[model samples]
Target chain A: MAEVMEKTALFEFLCRMGDNTLILGHRVSEWCGHAPVLEEDIALANTALDLIGQTQLWLEYAAEVEGKGRSADDLAFLRDVWDFRNVLMLELPNGDFGQTLMRQFLFDAWQVVMLGHLVRSSDTRVSEIAEKASKEVAYHLDRSRGTVIGLGDGTEESNARMQAALERLWPYVGEMFASDETDAAMLAAGVAPDPASLRAEFDAIVLPALAEATLTVPEGDFAHKGGRDGGMHTEHLGHILCTMQWLQRAYPGAKW
Target chain B: MVASVEQVWDWLDAVPDPEIPVISLVDLGIIRNVAWAGDTLQVTVTPTYSGCPATSIINLDIETALRDHGVEKIELKRQLSPAWTTDWLSDKGREKLEEYGIAPPQPAGGPERCPHCGSTAVEKLSQFGSTPCKAQWRCTECLEPFDYFKCI
Candidate 1:
């Protein structure tokens, strides 16, 4: 039973990742035409597109491997709010360009490291997906880091706002690094990154970024947890899921 | 003496990049070699990157295009040991990519010139673009935004 539970847990974790990217991508797509500048607008839209693309690949693969008979489309569009497994960090609103960059920088920093570890996953399919995705995310993280430092130090108003965004986002940051049994075994099996190992590297990459951005890391002793193994979510997921799954639900035999 | 290789090159000119959809893989520079061994047509290709989602699509597209023309057998070997890079794009491919509204892969030397107006006065808006092969860039002169196929 432990083996079966572990496998189910692994499936759920992948779903969390897939859903996070899908929702965040949808939110970023909202900025497609209305960015402060044309180039930046397209930039945000581009990231959004890539994230969604990644989401589709992973979600479809996850659905297939788990024998769920749901395509990526079915999982993405048919799930209800409680069924969603993405962390709350991804569901938060896009406050401004500053907020978007903060969220992306934080997530991408961890993801690049995570994907690097996952490239060697015991599961060949997962490994293949990560091996392919890592390069793309590396490029993604580079852009996010550049914008964070550039805008953070660019001008007076930009710097202050970026700092505020970082502060607002810092509290939720710890949730990603909190590992449970699913993590420890996966780490030993080389199916996942050891949160213990990732914690330091993630800090190394993120701390300097914050310093350059002139932002302070939130000094909270409290760390948020319980999204990955599946429990609780922000209020936003239901609305997002409703809209996403509408097409699949409304027309069961739809083709794209 | 060997017959001219230009015919083989022309045959490959018909196989286009799956993502960009405008330029041939030959122009994109991923088709490394086209050779003949007995009656079989051997086409050597490399990916833009190892994990590129379009890699398999491109390979299948090349084989199908060649087979439809009665090339007996196609050997599409993926050369990933040295890895794929963006530097392979031909000048013609660059021009065609720009015409198609997707920038060709930026040549090494910092970044690429703006595809819209050939201005060096271009800026990178994002590292990602509408597709994986491109990055968003805007030209100062033409004031028209375009995508730059980023250097891998």
Candidate 2:
């Protein structure tokens, strides 16, 4: 039964990743024509494309491992809110460009490091996905970092907005590095890196950039968790799902 | 008669990229490996970007090309290990990109040059282009706008 539990744990891990990217990509896509500048509009969309692409790969593999005939589309569009395993950070509304950048900067920093370790996963399929994805994630990290610096140090209004965004988003960062039983199983099975073990590197990559941006990292210890196991979620995810899944659910096998 | 791996490669070399018709997929370094297992022929490809819309089309195109060549059993694998990069682009691919009016990729973080006039004076108009793989840039010297294949 331990073997079965480990398989379930791996499935959970992959779901969490796939859901995170899918939701985040959907949120970013909202900026497709609404960005402050034309270049930014295209840039955000490009990032969204990369993320949604990664989401498809992960969920497809997740379905394969489950030995179900489900395609990636089935997993992404058919799932209800309670079925999702993405962290709450990704579901938060895009308050402004500053908030979006803060959320991305934090998540991308964690992801790049997480993927670095995942590239060595004993499950070669997982490693292959990471090797392919981390390259795109690196570019994402670069774009977010540059924007954070520009806005954080730009002007009084911009700096204040950035700092406020950072304070609001920082609590979510802790959830990413928090480890539980699923994480332990994946790590022990050599299929995932220990989230706890990656904390130092996460900070190392994030802190200096924050310092350069003149933004303050929140000192709060309060963290909201539980999405990894699909128990908890923010209010935002339901609305996101309502729109994202509409075409698929309504058409019941829609294709472009 | 079963098709040899070399013969399959020759057929694939003629399949141009769906978006950029000037460069063949083989020259673009998208085709990674061709092998034969018993009577089956297997082709491997890597996408330029995880999200590139061209991936599926390219896959179908390969299958069609091979099928037309009388290959009975064919398997196409998508390999992501040692992921695709702009550096994989062959020299002929680079020349084709330039000749087609898109600036070939430079070293990562390198400056963009105008494919029109071969001038280094250019400004990026957008980080994105007509497609995900290219960026819009305008040359100062030639005063002509062009696409630059992003150094991924």
Candidate 3:
């Protein structure tokens, strides 16, 4: 019984990691060919590709741990929104290029710190995945941090847009650090660090980058929760899944 | 009859990287291990990036190259530990990349010289390029754009 519970917790934890990348990847891919400039469009598409690729690794591992005979594609394309474990911020709409990048910067900061700790996970599979992912995440954080700084400090209009993006995205940030029983299980198993434990390191990376960008860190820590725990999600996730899962839903085993 | 592991390596060395065709997979340094497990031959490969679109193609290319060489019982294993790094790129690969008009990765986080003009004046156009493994850079001296294999 305890073993089953542990497996269940592991599956949940892995889903959280995979779903974040999948949802955020889809959001980023939406910018392809639509970005303001040629370089920016290519960059966004590349970023999206990386995220989706990482999603495959994470979800493939998740499915193996679940022992449910489900493949990564099934978990990605068949699950309903309520079953998703990604954070609320990832599923939110891309308001603009600045907003999209601002969201990326915030998420990349958290991911870099989180993956750093994960590299030391007692689970070798988790550690291996983290080891591979950290390199890519490092590059991502570098690009996003530079873009945030460049745009935030550039013009009066650009600064206003970046600041607004920060404010809008700030509330969702707290949910990333919110801990619960699943985190407790991971911590006890030495599989991962507590989500709350990651906040200090995340802030260390994010706060300074924001400062360098001349952007405010926002006031208060009032967080809206329930996404990671799979309790509630924003309305936007269903719409994303509607389009993302369309082919699989309609064809019921479509292949290339 | 089983082909020797060294022979397998030699065959694989002739297989070019699908994306950068100027360099072979061995030169790219992603083929980690090759061995025979009884009657079956196993080849271990690592991906340059987790999300790189070329990984599948690279794997298929390896299989095709091996089969063409008459190695029928084969297994391609994907290994993720220790990860892949540009530091593993062979010196021959670096020279080929430069000769092909693409700058090689540098520890300084950018290109040291232009592949087109061999001039030290170069600027990064974007952090990303046409593929996941490269970045866009331009030579100020030649007024030409080129790709740089990003050092991970």
Candidate 4:
């Protein structure tokens, strides 16, 4: 790949990573006041803040790499649906407590494995960010896993709810492993890990936990893809962007 | 007379963390190095978390603190090689955190203790708290809820 192409690929990869966290953070924040308990309310909010804070760093770096003079806010609060590159699993509505936990557990399981590889990235900045984020995600994985296990084994109603959530979310899990030209370029450049390689580890980490919780991993060959190329997103993303970008779009150069 | 590096260190010791407020940035173990680099005072600091909101403010505070001590031409370098950990926190800093009703972080994977009543009968209320660095906890013995600075 040419130097310019490599940079563009790297930029897209960063955007994809950033958008995943940014959109998921928005969904998690919706639980701020509505969580079943005050402790959960605070925990979910803290997770949201961590994800958003990470969004700031990743997007800011993406903007810098693009050399378009765009700030992190510009990229985050101004992008459109076709421009977003987050996996569909992240943008799905947080249905119930079980659904929310299922969504988070599925993602956090993959993220922990992914970050383990990213921490050893050839890129210094990428590795640094990964190193810091891995710690937080490790804790996140523990919390989500514990909640999922408890709910899965707790009662008939809880078990049924978790089973449904798992089936709904399983299709999206495949999309997380699908790679594109940008991912190939990033992997070649040693700036990113081979996302394909993380899939087995993700399954290894998530499976035993699921079994321990007495939950079944749903079978789904109908995996969805395309967010990586910035060509598509779920309907939920539009509403999220509308609310998240409102202040910036209205003021054009808003600051607080 | 030019101020010694010790003087600069003293100034930083007085700079409280914006989030915890009870602990100094130096005592909290964020400051990695402070030295003169070619007519400029260079301070190397590591953020506790990559996304910590206090990172920029902590940098600004370091600059302001040094400038107030009549030091000019200061440089702040953010290093992340050896990521910041709770083990870096000074003993005095841990005491301050406990005194403020926030349990200081134990070594990674260590059992948590209650900041209030010195009870080992503490359960986590949440894995997170008011700030990214802390977790909410409550003691069964004293029944007092508090914040635990999570080891990260």
Model number with the top DockQ: 3
Better of 2 and 4 by lDDT: 2
In angstroms, give how far residue A95 of model 4 lies from its true place: 1.3
Off by over 4 Å in 3: none
Distance from true location, Cα of B7 in model 3, Å: 0.4
- Clashing pairs in model 4, backbone N/Cα/C closer than 3 A: none
Runs of candidate 1 exceeding 4 Å displacement: A1-6, B1-12, B18-22, B26-109, B112-131, B136-147
Order of quality (DockQ):
3, 2, 4, 1
TM-score of chain B of 3: 0.98
Q: For model 1, how does the per-residue alpha-carbon lDDT over A46-127 read when each residue is reduced to its tens digit?
A: 6776688778767977797578688887778877777776767788788998898889999999888888787877877678
A53-163: candidate 3 lDDT, tens digit per residue: 999999999999988899999999999988999999999999999999999999999999999999999999999999999899999999999999999998999999999
Worst 10 residues of 2 chain A by lDDT: A226-235
True-vs-predicted CA distance for residue A239, candidate 1, Å: 1.0
Give per-residue CA lDDT, model 3, range B19-134, as digits (tens). Answer: 99999999999999999999888999999999998999999999999999899889999999889999999999999999998899999999999998899998999999999999
Best by lDDT: 3
Residue lDDT tens for model 1, B31-106: 8878787766778886664335687788888888877777766677654323356667788887887787766664
Q: State residue A118's C-alpha deviation in candidate 2, in Å.
A: 0.3
Lowest lDDT 10-mer window, candidate 4 chain A?
Answer: A226-235
What's the candidate order when arranged by decreasing lDDT?
3, 2, 4, 1
Tell me the TM-score of each prediction against the true structure.
0.79, 0.96, 0.99, 0.95
Clashes in model 1: which pairs? Answer: A77-A245
Task: Judge candidate 3 at residue B50 and give its lDDT.
Answer: 96
